[model samples]
Target: MERFIEEELAIAKSVDLCAVAEYLGYTIRRVGKYYTIKEMDSIRIYSRSHWFRWSRQYEKGENGGSQIDFMRVFAGMEVKEAVFWLLDFAGYRRIEEPENRIVLKNQVVDKQEEKKTFILPVAAGSNTYLISYLNQERAISKVIIDYFIKKELIYEARGYHNIVFKGNDKAGITRFASMRGVFDKEGRAFKCDVAGNDKRYGFNDVNENSDVLVVFESAIDLMSYMDICADYESNKLALGMLSDAPLETFLTEHPQIVTLRFCLDNDEPGRKAAVELMEKYYQNGYEVEDCPPPVGYKDYNEWLKATKLLQRVPEEKAVMKSAHGMAK
Candidate 1:
């Protein structure tokens, strides 16, 4: 068994907890002076090496500490394993000492790392459940859903019957996919990206000849926008998460795109990202616009539901009036 010295352990503990959380696929967001995880807001990252889970504090009694504790608790790693993983994450390698002792050493390598192969989930025999959920529950139009289904951009996955949204590269190769649950649980639908998803290739509907791009936070919201504006001709992208990696890649691939419209959610994090991205891309010389959902709506889907409901009111009233005239 390899053992680490106190100094080596200290270095491992000093690794940034926020970076570790992000690397583990948890979304971290800044709230006031501390950082909070998006999926589990009860946990707060106090500093580079310190964190605590408020929700577990009373039940578990002092439930967090340095990066070591974070890895052990959240990542389910052993003490020595956590230390080794942290050292590796911080770019340090283990040097074997005499009698099974391990010393941390900074080693540099010039070789490029191999890329992870992206594999999509197995497809369901048919998109029956997917089409019903999106069309009936989400209020997304069948015309729009059928269009994307025909393009091979949307499908139902096997087992869970998740709605899988695929993202393709410039050569039209699927490099990323995100899944949304067909059914809601506890008032929230399950959402997650597929393993080996390349954030640089976000789920998108691109018009190569168009010079404009409209960005959204999720694939459903992108499709919602399509239903709202049937005549829209510009490119559309869903980041899958609140990061600019996909936007950056899209811009690099399509040099013709000059205008950007951000349609992120009407929430704090969404607004903050929109502001930052708008300024950053504007400085890069692209025309940028902040086009969030209308007031009182949380997202484009919510807005679409309201718009659809209002459109049916007049028809409903007409039916009632016709029945009353017949009775008279």
Candidate 2:
């Protein structure tokens, strides 16, 4: 049991809360060491941390850990599922749930905590950096990117070149903010959420009248897939979870969700999470499919990169041929 505990704790420390938020579909904003959401005040996910783990503190109470505990407290997920989801979220390909998983009691919530308000970061002058990063480096379509900016779903934050992903409630109040640095260099990234946040709000494209729900781990992944499949469908909702915490809630709110598709990363944890969700929802009579990247690809972004490269190559060869024919 000690070994199990140690191992599980290690996995918890590895979960990325921001990624979890994006995967779970929560809106988070960061201002220094605090991350707050719109829906849940008193609770703030601590912003200062490495990629290996995250910490949370409640103004009215105390109950915190990394992504694992976030899922447990926020989503009421069991320890096994929480750990499994976190491990997968981290792309910890080797971490697997044991056949006979240990069941732990649920986290105790503090009822007396006062609600708090979430604030968005000061807005930037322009999305120059945001546009460049998503378009040139990430290769996303400008039209699609413009749509998000136009919809106010994302923007460039003031003071830094970080990108802001906003989460708004039904009343249209901005509740969650997740900011990510555009300066990552193949290592750890700079990101955080605003303090005093609520988990109820998310960066979603859910259609009340739609019957299909497409889930992804991050907004970039969701948008990348959107770039690949350019056709639009209003009856289909595309929701990206910063973590999987919001999966259950989104489904609950949308009883019309009959077809569930997971477009998570192609790693082991991503696949594991997809399978688990499929089995759980399949039993509930939902049509489910695991849609990872094409074989040998790590993610939609990678696939997009390769596809774009191939396309350019053909065009370049065509140009070369035309020049040669003209010379003849």
Maximum-TM-score candidate: 1
Model 1 spans with C-alpha error above 4 angstroms: 1-116
How far off is residue 54 in model 1, in Å?
A: 42
Cα misplacement distance, residue 161 of candidate 2 (Å) = 1.6
| Candidate 2 total steric clashes | 37
lDDT of 1 by residue, 1-328 (tens): 1477665675676566776788899998999998999998988888546888888887562577878888888888888888888766644446675776666689676798877677888998899979988988789999999999999999998755778999998888998998876644112345677777887889998899899999999989999999998835899999988999999999999999989999999999999999999999999999999999999999999999999999989999999999999999
Q: Each prediction's TM-score against the native?
A: 0.65, 0.61
Cα lDDT listed for each candidate: 0.84, 0.67
TM-score for model 1?
A: 0.65
Among all candidates shown, the one with the greatest lDDT: 1
- The regions of model 2 sitting more than 4 angstroms off are 1-116, 234-243, 324-328
